[model samples]
Target: MAGGGGITPIESGIIEYAIFIVLLPMLAFPIILFLGHIFNGNQTWVKSA
Candidate 1:
């Protein structure tokens, strides 16, 4: 009975960690791209004459 209870929390933790790992890269990519552009300064802005 005690062993069964242990499985429940462990299973829950695995699911949560899997979700965090999957979501982190989705969030990280955009932030990295934005920072790269800001730091690199290669892009041009146009102004009207």
Candidate 2:
């Protein structure tokens, strides 16, 4: 099941999941910021971390 980028279907799926794994933690920052704003809180320190 070869596709574009020379990646097989299995390899593409693995890569997609791996990217999601890596990005999931990085997405926490924005979620924290949004939640903070809703609670009338500030997250200046979270931005630095």
Candidate 3:
């Protein structure tokens, strides 16, 4: 396991968690921007930037 013999369940779970952790921020930013635009069409925070 430590020397890369076979894939362990714990190792797979860690990879899954790592993928989710990396993706969440990427997903959240777009969703938040869309929601903010929808809710505040005229006063969008993104417009100032």
Q: List the residue pairs that clash in candidate 2.
A: none
- Using lDDT, give the best candidate's number: 3
Candidate 1: 10-residue stretch with minimal lDDT: 40-49
What's model 1's lDDT at 41? 50
- When sorted by lDDT, best at the front, the candidate numbers are 3, 1, 2
Model 3 is weakest, by summed lDDT over 10 consecutive residues, at 40-49
Please give the lDDT score for candidate 2: 0.77
lDDT of 1 at 6: 54
- Candidates 2 and 3 compared: the better one by TM-score is 3
Error (Å) of candidate 1 at residue 41 is 4.5
Write one digit per residue (lDDT tens) for candidate 3, span 1-49: 4586889999999987898888999999999999877878565454654
Assess each prediction's global lDDT (C-alpha) against the native: 0.77, 0.77, 0.83
Ranking by TM-score: 1, 3, 2
Query: Which digits, one per residue and each the tens of the lDDT, describe model 2 over residues 1-49?
Result: 7556776789988977998787988999899988877866456545534
RMSD of each: 6.6, 8.3, 5.5
Candidate 3 — which residues are off by over 4 angstroms?
1-8, 41-49
Error of 2 at 45 (Å): 22
**Number of backbone-clashing residue pairs for each candidate, in the order shown:** 0, 0, 0
